[model samples]
Target: MKKRKLVMGTFGGLLLLFGAVTGFQTLTLESRQPAAKPTSVEIDKDKALQHLSEAITYQTISYEDRTKFDFSEFDRFIEFLQNSYPSIHEELALERINNYALLYKWEGTDSSLNPIGLTSHYDVVPVLKGTEENWEQEPFSGTVTEDAIWGRGTLDDKIGVIGIMEAVEYLIQEGYQPKRDMYFMFGFDEEIGGEEGAKAIAETLKNRGIRFDFVMDEGGAIVENMVPGVSQPVGVVGVSEKGSATVELTIEGSGGHSSQPKDQTNIGRIAKAISKLEETQFHAELRGPGEDLFEFVAPEMNLGMKYVFANKAIFKPVIEHILLQEPASAALIRTTIAPTIFQAGEQSNVLPEKATAIINLRLMPGDSLEEVKSFIEKTIDDKQISVSISGSEATKVSSVDGWEFSTIQQAARNVYGNAVIAPYLMVAGSDAKHYDDVSNNTYRFLPVQITAEDLNRMHGTNEHVSIDNYLNSIKFYAELIKEANK
Candidate 1:
């Protein structure tokens, strides 16, 4: 009876210690809010909307096969920009790279300060052939309905292009002079790898020995219900983008009739290899940008979630396991494996001599392509299957505790007073990656509030943006300019 009582007392003491640790963590959490000095810049809503609508009419579609591009449309779009913003053309020095990409320099009073860059792609993905009729309006009509503007490029990017132009024009009208040099770069072929557009532009600037303080591009945006615990809409700024690699697994061996097949066939081996890879995925651990995301949001989480995240040192494995259950969340902490294409025999009775499978991988910030290849070779553990990998490595992680990031957060908070602004990792590729060599830091964010459904419309049918969202985007750009210069 005395031993039983001692065991119970020890158990109760352990529970009390756990509770005390969690309570202390929650109380000591830091606030993410920054002092915001927003601009009172008034935008001409009607004019900005008209510019976006008209800009959409020109189908600046990018195709993998460059010969299919209609240069006439590109020429017309350039003409429209020249006519639309006279002040920009008159004051800023404009240079055209590769005959289509635009580079504009807005010289500041102080050349001592490093330049700032604002980049956006004008080229858009081609609308699926048969899905054009499914749209609420014609894909290229650029129709402005009652509340929303309907078109292809409205949300994907044209918003960024027009929004920046409108803000600069408004600032020019308000006689607001910047203290730092500003560069507005528009890429013509971002949808198709950006090799000729942004990549070439970055090379040009690097050769000139020019460097920038920071470069802002279109990426993450404000969304509701994105973070688990935060009730307010969170505005995510992407500090690093995941690397993309295409790994091909191929097997070449003898082919025979299905009726008299060998004990092991090419198809069976490839299938087994893929199965093994799916079953044994890359290790999932909470670190780098993924950990930073939770750290920023933990303080704002409810008591229950706050307790778990605040004590992350002890609960990291549990949190990672929970996050790994969802595909979207799993991508945050580990390299993703997706089998995209498989090519094999054409006839049912005959086995093909060669079978090939293509796997697309989105690598974590610190993961190298060579390491990914090694993992696959080790995981499959088959000498017969030839493995080949090629792609870019993950971008360098940017600083979150610096004034540069604080300026962006402050601008977003100043405009979106209710939003919880935080830094995150981007899973997809963007033009921002091209500027990494030319700038000290590159940030990816599009100043707009969108729902999950709206996100789908970026490259899908019925793409649209509301009038209020577009206007707010312009205000954000204008306010960001002021904030960064200050």
Candidate 2:
């Protein structure tokens, strides 16, 4: 009886200690959001809206086939910038890389500091051939209503180009100068890949021995409901971008009449391989930027969520499991596999001798192509099947502890005072990745409040930005310049 009583007391004591530890962690978890002093500058509302609308009228679309690109439209875009912002053209020294990418250097009073760069791609994706009719406004019409500016490129990045240009023009008019040099780098072919546009600019500056203090580009936006626990709108900055890679699986075997086919044919083998891959997907581990994301947001979340996240040492496995349930959350934790193309039998009757499948992957940081290939080979476990992989690895993670991030965070908060700005891993490819070597740290964040629907509209039909969102984006750029130099 005495032994039983002792065991009960010991169990109660352990539970008390556990609760005490978790409670202390929860109470100590503090908000990482910088104390943003809200400030506003009067930007011409009518003129700003008009400028973005007019900028969208020019169709600078990127095509997969080089021959389909209309360079004349790009020419018009360059002309439009010249006519729209005269002071920017005359005051800042400009160079056109590859006759398309624009690089503007704004010299500062202090030569001791390294220059900063603001980059965005002006090129927009081509509207699908048949999907044009799906748009509420014409795909490239640059439609302006009472509340919004309707067109392509408004969200994907033309807003970024025009926003930066407009902000500089405003500052120039105000006779403001910076202590550190600033470069406005705009790429033309980011939609397809920035090979010709962003790549050339990085190469040009690299050969000249010019290194940036930090380079900012268009990426993650401010959105609500992005994380399950947090209620306020969260603005995520891309500290690192996941590498995009292509992996292909192929099988070749003997072919015969369909009537006398063996139990395992080429199509059957490839399909079985795909099934195995799906069943044994990439292992999910919540570390790196994904872990950082929760750390910053934990303090802002409700008590229940804060309790779970604050005691991460004990609740990490539970948190990872919960995160793995959602597709977007799962992406933050692991590499993803998407089967894009599958080719098996051409004709219905004859058994095919060859089968091939192509998969598109977004790799997490520290995951190499070679390791990915080995995992695929092991998972499939079929000697008859051959696997091939190709693509770049993930970009190096940037530091959130530096002024580079705090400047962006502060600027974003100056305009969006109520938001929770946090660092996250970008799942898509952008021009920022090309400048990885040229700059010590590269950051990607498009300053706009967007929704889940707005994400689809970016490269899809009916892409548009609300007039207020458009205006606020300009404010962000203007504030970013002021914050960076200060």
Tens digits of per-residue lDDT for model 2 on 16-115?
A: 9999988999999988998878766779998888889988999999998979999999999999999999999999999999999999999999989999
Work out the TM-score per prediction. 0.98, 0.99
TM-score, prediction 1: 0.98
- Regions more than 4 Å wrong, model 1: 1-4, 35-39
Clashing residue pairs found in predicted model 2: none
In terms of lDDT, the best-performing candidate is: 2
Worst 10 residues of 1 by lDDT: 31-40
> lDDT of all the models against the reference?
0.92, 0.93
What are the per-model C-alpha RMSD values against the true structure? 1.3, 1.0
The TM-score leader among the candidates is 2
Off by over 4 Å in 2: none
Q: Give the worst 10-residue stretch by lDDT in candidate 2.
A: 33-42
lDDT of 1 at 97: 97
lDDT of 1 by residue, 1-486 (tens): 999999999999999998898889888988776755565778887888899999999989999999999989999999999999998898889999999999999999999999999999899999999998899899999999899999989998989999999999889888889999999999999999899999999999999988999999999999999989889888889999999999999999999898999887998899899999999999899988888888888888888888889999988999999999899899999999999999999999998899999999999988999999999999999999999999988998888888888888988888888888888989998999999999999999999999999999999999999888899899999988988899
